[model samples]
Target: MKMNNYYLELFEGRKNIIILPHILPDGDTIGSSIALFYALKKLEKRVYIILNDKLPSNLKFLNANSKIITTEDFEKLSIKPDLIITVDSSDTDRLGDRAYLLDLCSEVLNIDHHSTNTNYGKYNLVNSKAAACGEIIYELLKKLKIYIDKNIATALYVALSTDTGSFKYSNTTPLTLRIAADLIEKGIDFSFINTELYQNKPINKIKLLSDVLNSLELHFDGKLAVIYVTNDMLKKNKIDISDTDGIIEYARDIEGVNIAVLLKEFSDNTIKVSLRSKYDFDVSIIAKKFGGGGHKKAAGCTIYDTIDNAKNILLNTFRENFR
Candidate 1:
């Protein structure tokens, strides 16, 4: 899929631009936003990234230039952007408070790979077939004839690698590996990236993982696995919220478990639920029922209830849908 030239034409002579990634930023969102940011900077476009939270600790390497600004910074700015580009977000709500910034812009370009994308932008480039939005951004760069520097390659590689679970997930395709190979050809230290992302777990994270695993519960004839994380656990272990990243994989990896649910208890009343399915069952349906959306095998939603209540409702949904 080529870059929508209509949006490229909109880009011509446009000076003020902002690129946004979804809140609670992930590897895919950060990688896509940074890759696009560097590309636009090469074109001498004045661009900024609207980030709601601090960059994830593991992804700090991708922020070498440190150009990201908080939503507070955006609010203080008097200049409204001429263009806003949202990358990897399925819908505007995922933009958090920054979603309102879209209304102030004259033109918006949405780039995403999620099947549930809402086409909220004036010009949308959505390829659900792509393994990652970084893949789409790579294609768009090709269409625009932009040179991908090493930094750009590294960012895109991070996007593809993480979203596809380092090429282990069902989403991994031949094209994904090819793109990764091309990135390697650009001399990215793939080994180091893999280590930093997967191997370099801090002691706090390890402790949190231990607690999370200890709390794992099985239901529905051992087919549904559930893990819970409470704020109390984080407080005791001195772990940040980000430390819970990928903790759900432990439950999902268990033998005979068809689905895994991670019920994270935050300070607020809401419970964040992360869902993963082994095969056949569409977890996005479950996510959407609770006002969220994601891929078929991997999805998440926030439940405004106690951890126990959220876990019950989610497990029951799994039973109703799959059993």
Candidate 2:
């Protein structure tokens, strides 16, 4: 079932398409799904997107916003799907409640760029080299012979730009810029997308970040900068876990910091960890030891225990690896 070849026949069949993303959908999830939805609908095909979480405010401007369904809405439906295309989700569990949707679809297409992807689909197009799933969707559109207008370009732009940290991350390869260049040439407003996604953080988020930065701790001669945010901290600022998005970037950007870790506590007292590095540190290896996985430079894991326990495991492991 090679999608690269079936571009002709697949587009002709009118199917109830379901496009879904992983829990806590990011820019890559939203942008890639939206771009695919637009292309499918333009060809007079039935397409819908289901997100595991609410759409981030900044990404609400895509042309096909109305087509996105939340997990709650899908539960109330009674329709069988012709195709289920997952974007940015590595495993079935990442789809949360929408995992049931797989049973309703005749075919599954899993698209992702995560190095830790589990390839848990009938068809997988996992390219660790791609900057974002949006880039893969862009390629799929081209294979399907769909034209990229301004709106489609913008949708893809946000996905690649944010996932690559505005083209500053190590994942920003030569092809990444080529896709971005094509999108920009299509008249997508780069400045607007950048401002909307990065510059428009809520004031409370900024305040919470200030506190996280102030409370940051260092280990191994400042090679690893660790920050923690408990549920109490969330209640203190009236913010959700999503508000801590860029805190790790702050740690990674600090002078002399080769690696950064952000330990986030959920309401259930589980501690989620993010790991980022400046060089070939292979944070994915670190995350794997904790039953999680991701990219070489940026990865994450969740421990169903205290931050102290997770931190100890990390510190001890860091000593073993980098010390």
Q: Give the TM-score of candidate 2.
A: 0.93
The window of 10 residues in a row where model 1 has the poorest summed lDDT is: 56-65
In candidate 1, list every pair of residues with a backbone clash: none
Off by over 4 Å in 1: none
lDDT of 1: 0.86
At residue 165, candidate 2 shows an lDDT of: 91
Q: lDDT at 69 for candidate 2?
A: 76
State which candidate has the highest TM-score.
1
Q: Which candidate is the best by lDDT?
A: 1
Could you estimate the TM-score for every candidate?
Answer: 0.96, 0.93
- Error of model 1, residue 215, in angstroms: 1.2
**lDDT of every model, 2 decimals:** 0.86, 0.81
Tens-digit lDDT track of model 1 for 225-319: 99999999989999777668788899999999988999888657788888999988888989999988889999888899888888888767777
